[model samples]
Structure formats: structure tokens, C-alpha cells
Target: MDEGPQFSLEDDGAGGNRLVLSGRYLVSTLGRTNQQLRAIDAPVSAVDLAGVTAIDTVGAWVASTLAQRHGAEITGAKERSLRLLEAVKIRESSGSVAPDRLPVWQRVPDHVGAMMRDLLRGMAGVVGFLGQIILAIGSVIRHPSRFRGRALVRQMELVGVSALPIVGLMSFLIGIVIAQQGAVQLAQFGAETLTVNLVGRITLRELGVLMTAIMVAGRSGSAFAAQIGTMKLTEEVDAMRTIGISPVEALVLPRILASVLMMPLLGAYAAVVAIIGGAVIGEVALGIPFLNFLERIKDVVPIHDLWVGMIKAPVFGLIIGLAGCYQGMQVEGDSEQVGKRTTQAVVSAIFMVIVIDAFFAVFFTEIGWS
Candidate 1:
């Protein structure tokens, strides 16, 4: 039969009191022993558990608490009792309960501070990466033999030639939509003819380059990140370094060069294709001759509009390449990081491209390019 948990106070030879716990010290047997122990006002020098017949976590917690309250040494516990007491002590020390939530005012400022810190760190990383690229460029310039023309051509084909069909198709559809919408809005004013100007100026000055940049960022930027990140994961980059080859020159420069060189040609091609699509819409939907619509584009869309697109194209390309290559180079540890960095590359490139385009718009307007 189990006995109810009980305790007694005894005097030690040192004149301090000892706590002698006895019987089965379990939750069901504890009864009012918890209250009895809490009521004791005398200081305890030692918690003597030698008489404890059996103990559980709850019982251990009670004994642990008693010893802690009086700074008494726990004594004579069997291995199982000792283990239970230790586990309870560890749980208490590590906090078994959830922490209190911070107020909104404190949380908001704390979140903002953390965000700003992360932003600064990211900016520093980008700057350092840019510096490395600049140094690589200098090294390549000094040794022209180090330039990888074949890699540049391959990247050009992958980034530009392979993307042409989709880019053209998208631009064509966008052109038809723009012309149709512009014609509808202008019809109220009996100026449907101005649809030509709308499609021409918008596509050449903004939509052509902007949409192409976004597409390239999603396509080539993600590809760059994934490729380089995979290589990093496999230690191919490290192997290159071991062989005295600069990964930046052998990998990054070629991609960047190809993107920079191809973007203008692609943007111009997309704009022209879009113009053709608008012409088709004119001939089929608006009753204007296709050839007449094409002729009118040249008269209405100024050369400056084309110049704006061409100027933005290579800059957007550079941004995409840098974002992709930098993110890829930063990837470490696992394949999951490759996916994450690839996504970051695409998002960052697209965001930066849009921001730069906005700045370009303002600068061009101020300089009479608009």
C-alpha cells in the first residue's frame, strides 16, 4: 500500500533545520503536503529525500521548489528522483511559459530598426560585390587574353536570341491592347487617329524597354543565380579558385557583357514588333491601312523616344546581371539557399530596374529628352 506524502523537520548538528521528505511523493499522494511545506517558516539547511518511497515530476517539482526557497542542498535522492528533480529544475531555469508580448509602440520601432540594419548590411554587401567586379574588370583589361569571348557569345545566345520569340509575342499582344484601349478612349473626342501616337510613343519610350527588362530579370537573372548557386553548392567555384582562375572573370563578366550588349538590340526588336502588331490592329479593327499605320509611326514617334529606350536597356541589363550574379555568389550551404537567392535576384533586379527607370524619366524630362 502507498503512504501519503509527508515531511518532518529535524535539527542538524550544525543547528540548522533539515527537511526530511517521506512516503510516495506523487501528485495523487501529495494531498495537502504542498500547503504544509509552504507553511513552514523555519530555514532549511538540507532537503533529505532518503525516506522518499516514490516520486513523480510534480513531486520532484515540489521538493525542488522547497530546496530553492530556502537555498537548501537536496540530499539522499535515488537516481530516478534525482533525474526527475534535475529535469524539473532545468525546465524552470529555461522558462516553461511563453514570454510577455511587447506593446505596439515598442514593437513597431524595434521592427523598423531591425529592417534598417538589414538594409544597411545588404547595401554594404552590394557595394563590396561591385568593388570586386571593378577589380576583375581591371585585371581583364590589363590581360586582354583573359577575356572569354566564347562564353560571352554563349550567354548572348541564351539571354537574347533564345528570348526573342517570347519577347516579341508579348510585345505584340501588349501593342494590340494599347492600341485598342487608346482608340476607345480617343473615340469619344473623335481622335481615334491618335492611337498611332499612343502605341508608338508609349512602346518606344517606356513599355518596350521596361517590359523587356522585367522579362529578362525573371528569365536570365533567375537562371544566372540558380546556375552559379548550384556551382557554389558543388564547390565548382572553389575548384576554379584552387586552379588560379578568377570565377568573376570566367563566370560573371561574360554574363554581364552579353546582357549589356544584347539588351539594346532586343529592346529595339521588341519595339518594332509591337509597332507591327499595332499596325495589324489598325488594318483589321480600325479600318486603317497597315502600311499607312507603320508610316505614321515614323512621323509621330520621335527619334528621342527610341534613344530613351536604348539608353535604359543596357543599364537595366547591368542591374539584372549584377543582382543575379551577386545573389548566386552569396549562396551557401544548401540547395534551398540556391532557390532563395535565385528568387531574391529576380525580385531585386526587377525592383532596381523600375526604380532606375523612374529616375531616368525624371532626368530625361529635366534634360529635354522627354
Candidate 2:
């Protein structure tokens, strides 16, 4: 039979007190060992483990914890046991073990400061990315031979042609809703005819391009980020670089070009579809004829309203493309990071699109185009 662990305390003339441990220091012996330790009345200055016959991780933890609590020096440990003790000590000192908790008030400032620092760093990175994109575009303009026509066309098909059905359907429903609501309000004032003006101006000057941009940001922008981010994670982007190919030129410019070229056409299509939907609602519900709706739209909506909306489309597309590509480039070697960047790309693109639209609205208003 094996003997359990034991501890004894001795008075050392100059050393305050000494604790001696013997026998198998294992989990089965821990309770007795703890009881023996608790009975000690003297302040422990050192522990001698020379008599310890065998030990394991649980035993080491027990020994280390008692040593820490008593602020006692440990000695006479076997080489392997000493290494384990040292590792536990290192872990405790390094705060890898249980750490002290700070008050919530103290932690709040730390969290806020970290958040602010991250935000500043992110903004700086975006600015740097924008500069890089501009440099890439300038290089492409200087050397048109480097342009990838096939890639651009493929991206256009993905971003534009495939998007038409959803965009048309959403715009049509929105137009019908707007016309119905406007008719209700204008009827109260006996000015139901004004519903056509409301639908035409809102759809042509704002809603059409805004809705199209938002949808594209959610759909194409997230795809761009995920695709490029996966390529980054797989080292395909690095491979392109190694082969003397600019990732910006090969991957980014084609997408950006496709977006800018196709957005205006999509916006115009959305506007026409919405107007037709509104006309249907007006004819059926408000007793307004289709010809009368067309005449009213022509009279109320200026060509400049159409121009304003069209002009915003390319800028919105550019913002969406840049945001997606920038976030993708920022992705590290993590699948989780790819998903995070993809979501961030969509959010950032939509936000920037709205901001740009607001600026355009202000500019047009100041210039008397509104």
C-alpha cells in the first residue's frame, strides 16, 4: 500500500519556520495534506519537498497554491517537479491564471479608449486604401493595354444584368405604395392630381438611384468583399503579386469600372419601371388616365431631376466598389474575418452612398436644380 501525503512544520532558529512534505502528493491525498497544512501555527518561510515520493499535476497545483498563500520559498523539489512548479509560478505571475478584476468604472474608460483608437486607425486605413485605388486607376489610364475587358464584362453582367429583376420589382412596389399614400393625403386637400407630381419627382430625383444603390451595396458589395477576402486568405492575391500582377488592376478596377458603367443604366430602368407602376395605381384607383399621368410627370419633373439622379448612380457605385475592395484587402487569414469584412463592406458602402446622396442633394439645391 502507498502512503498518503503528510506535512510537518518545524521552528528554524533564524528562518522563521520550515514546512516539510513527504509521501505521494496526489489528488487522493490532497484532503489530508490540506488538513495537515491548516494545523500549522507558525508562519511558513520555506517548504522542503525532498521526502515527496511521487507527484502529479493536481498535486503540483495543491503545493503551488499553498506556497503562494504562505509566501514561502519552495526547495528540495525533484527536477521534473521543480519544472512544473516553475511553470505554475510563471503562469500566475503572467496573469494567465485567474486575474484580478477591475471595477466597472475603471474598465469603462479602457474600453472606450480602445474603441476610439480602433476607429481612428480604421479611418486612416480607408484613406490610404482610397489613395492606392486612385493610383491603380491612374496606372490603368496610363496603360490601357493592362485593362481586362473580359473581367469587366463579366462583372457588369453580375452587377447589372442579373440585378434588374429584383431592382425593377422593388421599385415598382415602392412606387405603387408612394402613389397610394400620396393620393390619400392629396385627396384630403382636394388636390389628388398632385400625386403624379409627387411620384415623378421622388422616383426620378431620389428614390430610384438611392434604392438601386442600396440594393447593389447589399448584393454586389458583399460578394466583392467575400470573393476577394477568400482569395486573400488562400494566398491567391499574393500569388498574383508574385507573378508581377497588380491586384488592384486585375481584381479591383474591373469591378469598379463595371459598376460605374452600369449603375446609371440600372437607375434609369428602375425609374421607368416605378413610373409605370405608379401610373397603373393612379389609373385604377384614382381615376387618372395613363396619358394624363404621363403629361403630369412631364410637366412636373424637370430633365435636371433625371440628370441629378443619373449623376449620383456612378458615384454611388464607385463608393460601393471601393468600400468592398478596401474591406476585402484588409482581411487577414481567417474565415471569420472574411465574413466580418463582407458585412462591413455592405454597411460601409450603403452608408457612404447615402452620405454622397445627401451631399449631392445639398449641391443641387444650392445651385437651384432642386
Q: Specify the highest-TM-score model's number.
A: 1
Q: What tens digits encode model 2's per-residue C-alpha lDDT throughout 171-203?
A: 999899999999999999999999999999999
Clashes per model (N, Cα, C within 3 A): 0, 0
- In candidate 2, stretches whose alpha carbon ends up further than 4 angstroms from where it belongs are 1-55, 58-109
* lDDT by candidate, in order shown: 0.94, 0.89
RMSD of 2: 6.7
How far residue 253's Cα lies from its native spot in candidate 2, in Å, is 0.5
Question: In candidate 1, which residue ranges exceed 4 Å CA deviation?
Answer: 1-78, 81-97
| Best-performing candidate as measured by lDDT | 1
Kindly provide the TM-score of model 2 when superposed on the true structure, using C-alpha atoms: 0.76
Q: How far is candidate 1 from the true structure (C-alpha RMSD, Å)?
A: 8.4
On residues 1-370, what C-alpha lDDT tens digit does candidate 1 reach at each position? 8688878999998989999999999888787889999999998999999999999999999999999889899999999998998899933356558788899999999999999999999999999999989999999999999999999999999999999999999999989999998899999999989999999999998999999999999999999999999999999999999999999999999999888988999899889988888899999999879999999998998999999999999999999999999999999988999999999999999999999999999999999987
lDDT score, candidate 2, position 136: 87
